[model samples]
Target: MASAENESLDHVPLFPLNAAVLPGGRIPLQLFEPRYLDMLAGCLREQRGFVVVLLREGSDVGSQAVFYDIGTYVRIVDFQQLDNGLLGITAEGLWKVAVNRSWRAPDGLNLGDAERLPEEPEDVLPSGHSELAAVLRALLRHPVINKLDLSVDFSSAREVGWRLTELLPLDSQEKQRLLEIQDPLQRLDRLSSLLDAMD
Candidate 1:
């Protein structure tokens, strides 16, 4: 399964943002920078995808932007031209990946060589973990996040964990840390604890 998963692609263009995107997640982006515009065009033309990572350092645009080692595989699902002429893209996050190495292209696009991380199975949500879905459902009611149009699967602990990670207003570093965790139950437990602390 690991080999089959990794066989899709080894390298992708990296888009560093101030947030993390988990598997089974989606986010919208506005493309204005020349480098990113070209990258998006290539992905659309070739039917390929790009990596969305959290910025560890530097701005999303311009040089010297460093990103976390983990990211999500994203495919453009919908797109349109904004009134300002920027490209608006809605990308669905497919899977988690660990970036092994990266470099800057002449156009300043960062390309990452990444490997697919194995996804955890859909284990039953342990007792106490069911509250995770409840918490997420409450957050989903917000006007801003509701527009994300997330689909929930309460039976799968892994799905619940990823949705919670994406919905919470955690900082980029905190979200990146969650993305690195390999155990779904542990991620869910940690997220539940973090939410408890916030309450």
Candidate 2:
């Protein structure tokens, strides 16, 4: 494993595996392919975070995945071994970053340099929007999400943003865009639209 100092900073790797990971969100992945299984072993051993950029071009299946200019740096939070010998793992994103450049490593992991996104406007939900409250409340009660935690926090803009971003079933690309957006209120506004559409 590389030195811990090298493990941190902008040395994050890119998987771009047809998925997006929002800040403060968790993503579960199944490691089966030899290349990716090796990548997983590297990360687990090094405690290095990596990127999960969405697959934007070519056939959704069998296409080479590329790192989005923007991505979430995720740390593996849990892991399991399946009957098939594949590694099952869930990762929670710790930060959002912009990919400066990336390439596939000979060892099979996608390696890349990244720049962390600068802090942005507060992601506070617009207050006193009774319509929003009603819509979200109703949305929270949906059969699909009835068992979820839909609680909101007006006190913390980040909390509100995190809850909205993670609870929604948005497309990976859309979620990626939201992750890189700097204006928090704007992010909330976009999230509001997503929630409204769900209702």
lDDT values for all models: 0.84, 0.64
**Candidate 2 per-residue lDDT over residues 1-199, each given as its tens digit:** 3442345655566766555656656667877767677767778887776777666664223435544677677777778997878788887776777778777666556677877766555544567433444554565676655533334554555655654555567876777677667776676678777766777
Model 1, CA-based lDDT: 0.84
Point out where model 2 deviates above 4 Å.
1-11, 59-63, 83-85, 121-124, 129-154
The most accurate candidate by lDDT is 1
- Tell me the TM-score of each prediction against the true structure: 0.92, 0.75
Off by over 4 Å in 1: 1-8
Can you write out model 1's per-residue Cα lDDT over 147-190, one digit (the tens) per residue?
87888788788888888888798987888888888898999988
TM-score of 2: 0.75
- Please state the error at residue 31 of candidate 2 in Å: 0.8
- Clashes found in each candidate (C-alpha, N, C closer than 3 A): 0, 0
